[model samples]
Target: MNAPITACYPDPGTARPLTGLYLDHALPDRGRHGPFIYANYIASLDGRISVPADTGGQGVPESIANARDWRLFQELAGQADLLLSSGRYLRDLEAGTAQDSLPIGIDDAFSDIRAWRVRHGLAPQPDVAVLSAGLDFAVPRRLLDQGRRVIVITGESVPDSRVQAHERAGTEVIVLPNVARPGGAALVTALQALAYRRIYTVAGPFVLHTLLSANLLDSLFLTTVHRLIGGQPFASLCEGDLLAETGDFQLASMHLDAHGPGGCTQTFSRYDRTPGP
Candidate 1:
């Protein structure tokens, strides 16, 4: 995939093909409420999604990482079924200082996005949850040997012996009742009561500012790596109290992926969360 691309919002230059461009888009229920929630990132141009990495922590700032924005971040994690992540990315994946969780179907340059998730049935690698309210971390046995389904979501003040040590290591902890922290409509109504239609956070920016300060994100998919590096304890995209009024959004599409790094230019936006103001 050499990234043949174009487009400039709604539709302009046309000629697209960033590998199936985020797989059609499966959202409805008004905002895909049943589970069409979405999120994706890769910033810079002053937004700095991360920086200061010498392995002590923080990453993704190699002057706006490249490879055509990781092939649209593995085609948006190959159209997720469930991949919202956090808890400091499982403590930086046991402190090896992890990065690149956008690993789907084990990448052979995304094997045609894992055969488009087996011709659209999905689930050859998506099920991951995680979000942590400090239950601490450690769930990376290569994501349970790729069978997936490691879940863990958190809240309700944790510590029932850390939720029975992640349900005795079978891991499936979800605890968000009465809140102690777990917003964004209680984490998509608890993954829409565990049915998880198409939710996909792949966590960062404090869970995209808790689903855009709780209007419950419909779609985002940013990329913007036009280049810029100011360095100063960075990490952006959203990380606390400010966006409200449903954090309005609107650009339903846009692109420019002239490939990044030295080649520069990599816009790739996709907004869509503005039903009101």
Candidate 2:
């Protein structure tokens, strides 16, 4: 069952009640020439994104037992024009026990959001874009088939054999200039070239850290579950050394789900990047 939203603050400054918020109407406006990047992540109450030594801890049975979170996840995926993810996350999905296709929704649902996309002259399904330094991981064969569009972004150092393999599989492989690392700027440029204006990223900590460091992240939609996972060396939502300058995010909206099963509480918060002074 879909959890009822107890409270919604659409505008933090005004704090007015927002009623009847649906996924189709809640999506952000796309830019004309560039991408508006937003990320969605779920964390534990103790601020852990993953369990110790296990990167796929977020998929544990105890972590994602909430129906409300799953509903929101599907809604976000259904509304995005493009789904950006790191190569590691893609590989993890392949190796892990998760579902093969994108988790758009359960029971083949989200018809309303799909219809909205079509009415707006957009594809019903979002394209998947994977970012990696080198095309070393195994790209999903199903994703390479027709009817599905997949974009692979990597540096020039990727082997010619790998590039050919992806191309032969009908994947659009983009090779950027070789650098110490593939920064978010390069990824944004590639996204712009493809005319993808609304991008939703479901990335791990490392990718989030890089995007945040590059000032490429526009907003973050975080769900904090009421659980304390503090046994092992878990990673946070943003993992890396402290930045010389910190990024500031202003809370744009917040929603509360108080009637979660098992006395659990989930708080959904949206933070937009604050413009530089």
Instruction: Tell me the TM-score of each prediction against the true structure.
Output: 0.34, 0.85
**What lDDT does the true structure give each of the candidates?**
0.77, 0.69
Give the lowest summed-lDDT range of ten residues in model 2.
11-20
Best by TM-score: 2
Q: Cα lDDT for residue 14, model 1?
A: 87
lDDT tens digits by residue: candidate 1, 1-277: 5567899877788877777676665444235566777787889888988887887677778778777777777777777777888888788877777776535847476687778788878878888887788778768777777788888888898779988877787788988888787776787688778886777787888878877766678878789887788887867878776675647778988878786778887788888777652
Candidate 1 local accuracy as lDDT? 0.77
Q: Report the C-alpha lDDT of model 2 over 102-217, residue by residue, as the tens digit.
A: 64543645566566667766676788888887777776776655355888888777788988987886788888775535665676576678887678887778778877777777
Clashing pairs in 2: none
Task: Tell me how candidate 2 scores on lDDT.
Answer: 0.69
Q: Compute the lDDT of residue 25 as modeled in candidate 2.
A: 61
Q: How close to the true structure is residue 216 of candidate 1, measured as C-alpha lDDT?
A: 75
